[model samples]
Target: MHEMTIVAGVLEIAHRQAAGAGATRINRVVLEVGRLAGVEADALRFCFDVARSGLSAIAELEIRDVPGRGLCPACGASRDVDELAALCEACGNVLDISGGRELRVLSLNVD
Candidate 1:
């Protein structure tokens, strides 16, 4: 699905960074995935495995999940979330999420 394409993009960028930095291999990649990023973690992992072939970096990847933060307007609280339907724990009001809906490369550890 779209995860394949997304993984492809990731590889392209990681390849460039690794090559530019004169790193023999990319040891790890840290991605910040938002709760509403609409990306399936399992699917992304599988796609990454398939897409990283023949690249300068060997087939090794480490994924770190970043939880989304939602705002409880009714309660004026900020909370972390893993689900789309987030409710305020203080008053059980529907929480409005402001950030963490984007998939971004936070950092990469290279050799």
Candidate 2:
């Protein structure tokens, strides 16, 4: 799955950052994943465990799911959205994406 690749990238970034900071071990990884990012949280967790097993430093992974939001460009209004293509409630226009497209490593707890 693509989550494997995503976890690999995250591991790479974590290693780089930890090494730069002179950290001998990684204790935790905090990730902020948006609902619209198209990533399966369970798959990510599984892949992270498998991927980080070789590293010994990474101990835990925490995922934070963010809800989607949309903005109406015509009416300057914003609201929670469940789908990618949603019509604005204020105006009939197609809503622009305001949030919930994130796939980021929020923080790392290391030693």
Candidate 3:
């Protein structure tokens, strides 16, 4: 599955970062995944567990789900957005998505 590829990329990044910092292992990893990032949380978690099996450095994976958000230039209103329909709640206008499309590493605890 694509989750395996995603997990492999994450492991590679974590390993590189840990090695660069002279850390023998990773204690934890915190990830920020947005609602519109198209990633399934359960799949990612399972893949991460499988990928980190031999890597002693990665002990834990923490995922933070971020809500999709949008901003309306017509009414200067900004609020949480629905991924399917980005509409401004204040004015019922089409809004520009401003957030909640991220898939990135937030932090890591290495030692």
How accurate locally is residue 89 in candidate 3, as Cα lDDT from 0 to 100?
Answer: 77
lDDT of 2 by residue, 1-111 (tens): 899999999999888888889888888889999999989999999999989954434569899999999999899888998889999876789999889999999999988
* lDDT of every model, 2 decimals: 0.79, 0.88, 0.83
TM-score, model 3 to reference: 0.88
How many clashes (backbone N, Cα, C below 3 Å) per candidate? 0, 0, 2
In terms of lDDT, the poorest run of 10 residues in model 3 is 50-59
lDDT of each residue in 1-111, candidate 3, tens digit only: 987888788888888888889887888888888998888989999888878944443578899999998889799899887584688878899988888898888888987
Model 1: which residue pairs collide?
none
At residue 53, candidate 3 shows an lDDT of: 49
Ordered from best to worst TM-score, the candidate numbers read 2, 3, 1
Whole-model lDDT for model 2 versus the true structure? 0.88
Structural similarity to truth (TM-score) of each candidate: 0.76, 0.93, 0.88
Candidate whose TM-score is highest: 2
Which of 1 and 3 is the better model by TM-score?
3
